[model samples]
Target chain A: MSRRTSRWSVAFVAAVLTSGVGVLLADPHLVLLSIPAVVFAVYPHLTRPPAATLEIERSIAEQDPAHGQEVEVTVTLRNAGDRTLSDVRVVDGVAPMLSVRSGSARHAAVLGPGTETTFSYTVIAKRGVHRFEPATAVLRDASGGVTLETTLAADTELACRSPIRTLPLGHTARYAGSTATTDSGSGIEFSRIRSYRPGDPPGRIDWNRYARSGELTTVSFREERSRTTVCCLDAREICYRSSGDDSVHAVSYERAAARELLDAASDAGEPVGVAIFGVDFTWLAPATGSHHVATAHRTLEDPETLPIVPPTEWDGTPDDAQARELRTRIGPPTTVLLLSPLLDEFPLETARTLRAEGHSVTVLSPDVTTAGSLGRGVARLRRENRIDALRRAGVPVVDWEPETPLETAIRRGERR
Target chain B: MTGPIAIARRLLVGVGAVALCLGLLVLFGPPVESAIRWPWDDELLLVAFFTAALLLASVIGPFVLIDDGSQNQNQNQNRNRNQNRGNASPGAPERVPSTPTPGRELERVLDSRWPASLPPVRRRRIRRRLRRAAIRSIVRTSNCSKETARERLERGVWTDDPVAAAFVRAGGGPDSDSSRLRSLVERIRFPRRARRTARAVLSRTEEGEHR
Candidate 1:
């Protein structure tokens, strides 16, 4: 669409006033003064609006970027029409969640027929899948009287996943698995020798004990049990709080942690489940398989399940129903790895509730709180109090600050 | 009739063009001899006069008299078009400042009310919030009841600093009219007093936690 700017209307008004006064005064010079104004007013109408046919292509240097890495985005605009475009202003529609760290996303240039211009910018990669919007090009004619605005589409996406360096160690569950337990059973590691009983396997009997005492005795070994872990991610809008510039929300960190926890559990051949508590409760029953892990990751990637945009309006109440649903799903012998920012009281309550339900709950809270404003200071103090309360209740809480590496935080958690 | 009008318009445009060229020549070209009188001097003057009238009308015709309705519609259309394209970055949260100092919130509140005397109600509200924080800190660290914490705060014995204690002490009122000058001094020292009080409470909280 094209529209006139009417910028030279002042020239026309000046011309008429001068001509009217000249006629009344009968002065030829006054009339002559209106000539330039007339020319200025008519010049714009003579030139036509720019015929702009632009094709834009966007390219990202690294589509799969590491967390917090700067990625370069280049946009190439080609004037595909036969007419020269005198003034073209292109504003690239960068993803809303991503911030441009360097360079310009908006460019203004003069493009002749069959010419192209490229502009590059750097954006700090955040965790999540970010898709770029179309570029908007505003083309103006030489007269500046008319403008034509058009949108050029280019599909580009940035998927940044934070790598997990350390696996969570020293967790136990029921059933036979990799890690050795204290229970005496038929395993490689010897525990103690007992009096031999009927129906005991000959291989299980301790041959050395039998040879030494000439008595029948049964041998027991330490049991190996597979761990059942549930990586529960808090996706409520309240968990979307973030502190400092260029930082992703706490929900994003929780999602990343959940992904890593799932991978670790799956690798260890453990039955792992994922619970996403947001606007709706999404649950994946505990199971062990590559497909289950892939499904969990895919669910985390979907915006509907865990959105990049923080919800603006919500019920603003505690998610008691969601917590009830989760508690019913997880029982004894299953460890619940709760990843949350602990911004409000609900998460603390939820952790305590789950712990009270006989489930082993370990909270990995990513600290997104800052200590500047009175409100923020109070928030930080309250969060510390919450963690302290949880610790006093015998629930181990890992206070994970975002600036530190996840592995280091896990090690610190293990030590405590 | 249409053909005759068309020919007249074309002839008028040609005369205007010639007169414009002559005007430019007179402004920027070599000086013409004022003594050089021409045979068609009156006719040349008539042509210049007619050209100026025609040019003036042409300049004013489309913009002043005939463009009112169309221009507004065009502007409305352009605005709508821009609005349609403005949804490219919807729901993007604003980036927070990287360097935010602790107590900046209190600083902001005080700065916004600078120069103007803070209202008594606003002062009470700020003091109320501070008192609540002090009480919570005291109750947690000292393992005392909330009532006892409140009582300690009211008695101005919660902190070692007298200024901080008075800042959040219950029943702390504005100075009497007799001490008008002294009250002015107190108003000037409000921000500093608030900061000191906050620091004292926070320090107590920290110390209690260590203990």
Candidate 2:
């Protein structure tokens, strides 16, 4: 940005006034006095603003920091154009989600050609992948008559992924491990006795029945197989609400919780998938492997899939459409571990619909509602009502508070 | 520097400088001892000097002394833009867009639109939302029909908090003497009445939850 500071306009006016009075009075000495004023007025216009060419690079001490850890950021601004910048103000672009714990991100200095200036700031690490924005550099001329501002691009990011831990999936922990199915298969639990076929395993044959009745029979047992649990995240705009402006939005908490669930499920060697409903519906099919787990983590971390920024305009596709898509993608056999804030009634309705579809749905709602204001209080109560409704519908609702440990909330939900 | 305007500006500066120098020489230099020096020479020099000074003032005064309204407006606009941009600048604490909570509506009404000042349609809408929520809360806890919950709400038998009952039932029915007395008390206590009513409803819902 180039702007004229209107320097010495006052001196220019004074010079004109002095000259006018001197001419009217015919006093040569008075005219001579105005000469100094005239010089002061024209001095700034005599020198042109310097060419400001600068390059800035930012580096973080810990690229992948633990949650709440203080990470130091160093910014280096180099005067690359072989021209001296008199007054340079540089504001490093820190991710909005992270707060500066100590030090200043803004610095002002004068830089000569080939000379560099560095500033360091410390920011408290937050959950999520925070990418640094372009730093804003404002350069002012030596005379302060002109100012130029431009953004310096640097590819810097702090991927502060919270460590995952095993979470109790409430009553739905059955899905965390192998579940016994009613169908007869090769398992420990006896299902029934059937007439023996030639291909039947010899060990499965009921030799006692054969001896007693002179008929061959086979014994069947219930099938014990791992159930797939899809972490269906409600990233709808409504779920982006937070209790306060400075706090992380509910979607972030939900995202963190979803990752924990995915990690636990994969650790148990169960098939796990990730689904998100926000700007658009995203689905990752259930499978069991390290590659599958990595893919699920990538899906969870992808901003396009689950954006840290809330959607500006709703996708317009109603909740039913998303629920329908999720239902179709995740058949009845898959357990749905829904992560939502329950800010509105849609999540509750979706949970009920999913449960009605014969999918074992468990709701893990991060409580982002607060009692700061009467309106917020009402919002909290309304959220409580939704949670109550979900629980009454037999969908175990783990009402998670972001301030509390996720495991503690799950344990509380299990007790409930 | 190459534009026509720039060229004209340079020419003006040159002319002004020449005129200033000539005026200074005429004012301070030794007097001309020429034979043609007339009696009115001093007066003529003064008139010429005054004319040059007036011309210079006319040419340069407006440029330097006067403020440009358009430029000032642009500066103000730039200032506002800078402030707005600074909101997301480096080191600015992250802020999420806050969604309006339900009680905010009633809080607005109670704080700003008290008694009969609010538009009937808006007041009714606020009332309906609160009433519906309270009814659902009652029904959820007591396992009663919606109608019964609503009936209890209107009858002021839903909760022991009279102010809450009255706030919820505001503009719902005829004003009995006792109801009028409560409304008077509500008016006296004003802004907090709505909040109290919300608290009462929440508490009632909690009571049923425990049951």
Residue B181 accuracy (lDDT) in model 1: 76
List, residue by residue over A341-364, the lDDT tens digit for candidate 2.
887677788888877878888999
lDDT, residue A413, candidate 2: 83
- What TM-score does chain A of model 1 get? 0.68
Query: lDDT tens digits, residues A305-369, model 1?
Result: 67655544555434898988888888656788888887666778888887777778888898888
B42 Cα displacement, candidate 1 (Å):
32
TM-score for each candidate, following the candidate numbering: 0.59, 0.65
Candidate whose TM-score is highest: 2
Residue B31's C-alpha lDDT in candidate 1?
57
Q: Against the true structure, what is model 2's DockQ?
A: 0.23
Candidate 1 lDDT score at position A290: 86
The worst-scoring run of ten residues by lDDT in candidate 2 chain A lies at A168-177
Q: What TM-score number comes out for model 1?
A: 0.59
